[model samples]
Target: MELHRNRGALVLPLVCVLGGAALLLFARDGAVLHRIVGGGGVLLGGVVLAGLLRPFRFAIGADGLTVRLPKLRRLIRWPEIDALALDQPPAEQGRPASPRLLLVPAPGVDLGLPATGHHPRDGRAAVELLDLDRVREKPAEIAAALTRHGGDRFVDVLGLRQAAFDTSDFTVGLRGYQPDRVDALIRRGQDALVWGGTLERQAARSEIERTRAEGLPVAGRGYNTTQVDAALARLSGALTGDPSTDRRPTT
Candidate 1:
């Protein structure tokens, strides 16, 4: 893997420099609004610059590299792997299989994170099946949402019973989202929740993202998009640790 990419090396510094200059330039301007707007610009620029420098995406801990597998019962944490080789998946039931990269283990040493391989397809999507190891740390908020909007059908969220969700119970209002379409999407998430297969969480995540990005005509009456989006986001977060559809990581 390439050690570094310098895309932000120049642009970030330029933004910070320009923003600071603007802040100083407006410090002497008599009109209050100009100073206020300049201050806002400086703050926004600083925030953006901080974000550009924040090492969240580039940071990795000493746990080595953790890779979760399909049907995900276990994770392989490979350490001190210095070589990469391709590993093609064996076809199952006549369907295409995953093409992966195997981190060749240190020979005869056997002292480090165990050698592992993962499908390249994982890096292309939001649902990171093979990724860093970390607990989601939030289940009560999800359970509370299920209790509030899910009604009696959503008795136990951890149980993941699809039949417990009341997809058709939405109340319509002025200038809101299309109810039928939302219900159909909700049913898809329910199916994923019920199946609990290799693609179960992935399916729910896709549905949630699609719903958030979907463009529907404003009806005379329907469900509120904000509320629906929030609920779907929670469900997606419950399924996959990444919550916001808009905030999926880019590499």
Candidate 2:
């Protein structure tokens, strides 16, 4: 599967270009400060546009995975990959948190990518730290693809239980399910998946059913109903051990 850069990321560069053009149009004649500001904006926007326009050469193939840079291209075979996991570093300053892909090579294997740090679970050194923010595919889609190809080498560090809730990416609307109630249910569902027995799982399932039957209190600007329901469906499938459900092996 070939992954492409997110088109949403192009917004900033486009804005910069427009702003630069506007400044250039409004600037008084022979105004050096205005000219500098306009030129800087255009130049910065152009640079970012060029970088984004570069082809995304990340792909999964029959033999291995391909990573392409401006001057370097390498294929990391399946045997060379020890484990692959997705990590979310804490948000710094005011920026929102973004997911990163951790590719840990097997012992004594060098994939040629720079090592950012060690994996949290096994303490194995990771060769590349890939930012998924600019990638168009959802985290779940990427995980599914990698798990299918990488086999047991793909580790779901971000538990599927939690991911069911986190990956919903629900939209806020004028009236929808209550946020706190939904969050509480998600936590209970996660607990069931992680540590609960059959009875607990059944109970969680029942609670979900009841919650849906009773309908969560609709508040102004809450999660969209469609998205929340989709997430709940996935959670229910996971609780029931549906073969189609995606989950980490308990062992």
Candidate 3:
């Protein structure tokens, strides 16, 4: 599968280029201020346009992954990859408001890909970043594709859990399971899905049972008992290796 660039992002640069040209055309010959502004606009717009116009290609094939960008172009064979993680970049003033894909190479193997920055989880590893905000494909789609092609290499750090629970809306009722307890248990289950191992899976299953047995605290305004129970049952099924409830990629 080949990811496509976000064409919508081109609007600003296009506007800049056009507006700059217009300013240059209408500026008075003797007006230094107008001339400076016009020239600056054109230069700024041109630089940004050039950067945007650079060829960007990301493709996944049976044999390897292909990444073609302005400064990097290489086919990373499957064997060279140790792990492919989806990392959530911190929300900042001038950062992409989307998760990035990290290409973590195997030990002693250097693909020479440029590093945009360091991921907290990957600390000091020479991992390359693939910004998803620039790509038109949804992050879930990309994750699915990577999981399908990369198999065990894909480590879902954040997207999988967020995708599963971020939109969960349980019916709020006067008498029901405590929202905090249910949410905490659910988070543990989700984390197990991401960090899969026999031990972790078993622990998650045990926790689900213990939580169910102990019962959640009741609150005046809480999630519906029935809905919460159903959700936990499904989560337990997923932890217990029930194929029907298991939506995540196998570790």
- Residues 122-222 of candidate 1 have per-residue lDDT tens digits of 32111222121122222334334424432332223222333324333445578877666665566566545544454666877776786577765456677
- Tell me how candidate 1 scores on lDDT: 0.45
Q: Relative to the unseen true structure, what is the C-alpha lDDT of residue 201 in candidate 1, on a scale of 0 to 100? A: 65
**lDDT per model vs. reference:** 0.45, 0.73, 0.75
Tell me model 2's lDDT, rounded to 2 decimals: 0.73
Worst 10 residues of 3 by lDDT: 88-97
127-161, model 2: which lDDT tens digit per residue? 54467888888887887788788887776655654
Put the candidates in lDDT order, highest first.
Answer: 3, 2, 1
Score residue 162 of candidate 2 by CA lDDT. Answer: 60
Candidate 3: the clashing residue pairs are none
Q: How do the residues 1-251 of candidate 3 rate in per-residue lDDT, one tens digit apiece?
A: 99998887778877777887888899887877877777777788788878877999999888878989876698888998877888765534322246788877777777776656554333645465587878899888888888889998886666667654442668877887776677668767877766556678789879999979988888777888988888888888877774346565444
Q: What is the TM-score ranking, best to worst?
A: 3, 2, 1
Candidates in order, TM-scores: namely: 0.29, 0.62, 0.63
lDDT of 3 at 2: 97
